[model samples]
Target: MDHKQIPTEIDREVRIPFQGFYNTAHDNVFDMALEQINTDDSNDTVEVISMDNVEWTAVRLGYAQKYLAEIDKTLALNARFSRIIGQKDYAIGNDILLARVDCSKLVELHDAINADPARKAAWAYYVKEALTERPGFIPYFSAEVEDWGAFGTWDDAQIDCMLAFRGIELEIDETEIAMELMEYVDEKIWSSVIDPDQVPGHVNNKTETQLST
Candidate 1:
């Protein structure tokens, strides 16, 4: 695990008591990359957007409680066990059940909310106080986990046992795993792809290893 701690201010009102995360994608973040990669019709070009091939980043549009509850009441995708990728233990967390989620329906719900000018304005009021991203709301739920800290991580098959006998819990970033995840996103997804020359040498090496395999 990397010993470096990600700097974050934990706003209890916005974060604690385990309020769920609201996922969104910014056009400022993704559309430019889409334009960059789709400039040519080569074989390596992405014809369509899918979670598997593209290194897409999801926005944490703060803990918009009312909106999140409304969205959850309409969840269409079932959460499934996700294969934990990457080598950073700090970013991935330990002894946690990572759920692979598809937020297509979630995005659809947002679209419905957005279509109504009055509802969209009302929804914006709830999240305006928090740090928010906008323009593109391509919501996604990928590899989010609830963590129990200092607890041993599957060394003696404890995680498997928990899965078999007792169901896992779903909460966001009990140990600030989300913080590390965002850091990882900034470093790996954005920096490496958007501006390769600016990424550290070590990050490029790690990216190479991940791609080659």
Candidate 2:
């Protein structure tokens, strides 16, 4: 994939459905770590156009903001203090894996759907099964919003399962670029699943160079 595809801004006009948040590395050190993290050294074919900016049905938005500057600020802080942590099980709450993404665009989209009589009526009729079957449909993000409380109608552990299931989407203008950015982040974190050493750790408060090597 062309790393250059990732852009630095968001088109606020577009609204997207998002899943959760992910903490990703953005600097040269992180990039080098990612390269080393690839145990197979495989040249995988990364799809260019992603509707949700992720390859997974359940994408991890991972604390991503509408603006790249905000993301960079957080990454900088994390790197400065070497604050990255790890978990044995992808636990929810407090654990980075369980984090939720808050985007006004998604809130606005849901609101628009609620306000339109036809649109509001359509979700129940056509989207019931689809919504329930959404790769990880526990409604984690939806539950946080007051207006999205309608999803609470199906109250159950299914929501919890969805949270565990790591599938989510984020919609925005320049969606393809956004998707590329997400893919870039996932490459580093997901590698940890294969090789636990890739998970960022606070080893003696080590710097990025030490972590990458």
Candidate 3:
């Protein structure tokens, strides 16, 4: 059994509560690799122009996300298991199920839309058709904006530390197994991708992993 074990070195993680995390993200304290532009800098400076670029990229990403969510893409993805924690007054056995799908396709589409100057008007037209009435533009845009600044400011160590945020009941870090799989995937496929969203579901009442009933 040990030889066949999954070998996830998960016990080393800190279980920060899930509380205050969203607020932290908003406060510029979740430590995401987001831009820290000084508005004091002239409005038309290159930095501000770059900021505009990031925002526009993020806006298009929102359209892609809206289009994809309607597809329920998880039908072609991976799954993870968990139990409820940091919840108040829960039942004795509160297990939760989660799944995620690779958004590589939409991510590539977003990039292509953002890159081609000729497509700029086309994507703007698409966004007006699909994403304006939706609720995800800001969050979606913020993520892209953060990723842009992250490329310049965030290092591997900082990213590793980012994996250690509060309200973080569980940590899923890379292991030998994940690395091998990722290497295989990269070798087999060359594509850009989007981050997955957690799809929570109720399971057969398996709460053994919970810290308490």
Question: Mind giving the per-residue lDDT tens digits that candidate 3 earns over 104-200?
Answer: 3223333454577766455444334433445644322222222334222333232222223211212322232223233322211111111112112
Task: Give candidate 1 misplaced runs (Cα > 4 Å).
Answer: 1-74, 81-98, 132-213
Any idea what lDDT model 3 has? Answer: 0.27
For candidate 2, write residues 1-213 as lDDT tens digits: 133322223221211122223232322323433344443436653322222222221122222332232332332211112112233344552222222223233334445555777755654443344344466556443322233344323233333322222122121323343444655454424422432343344222111221110
**Candidate 1 vs candidate 2: which has greater lDDT?**
2
Q: Candidates' TM-scores?
A: 0.22, 0.26, 0.18
User: C-alpha displacement of 159 in model 1, angstroms?
Assistant: 28
How many clashes does each candidate structure show, in the order listed? 0, 9, 2
Give one digit per residue, the lDDT tens place, for model 1 in 1-213: 221221122210111122222122222333444444444556455433222333332221211222233333333334333322222343343222233334333234434655788755654443342213446543221111122222122122322322221111222322343332333334334323433444334333222212100
Poorly placed runs, candidate 3 (over 4 Å): 1-75, 89-148, 151-207, 211-213
What TM-score, to 2 decimals, does candidate 1 have?
Answer: 0.22
Predicted structure with the largest TM-score when compared to the true one: 2
Higher-ranked by TM-score: 1 or 3: 1
lDDT, model 1: 0.30
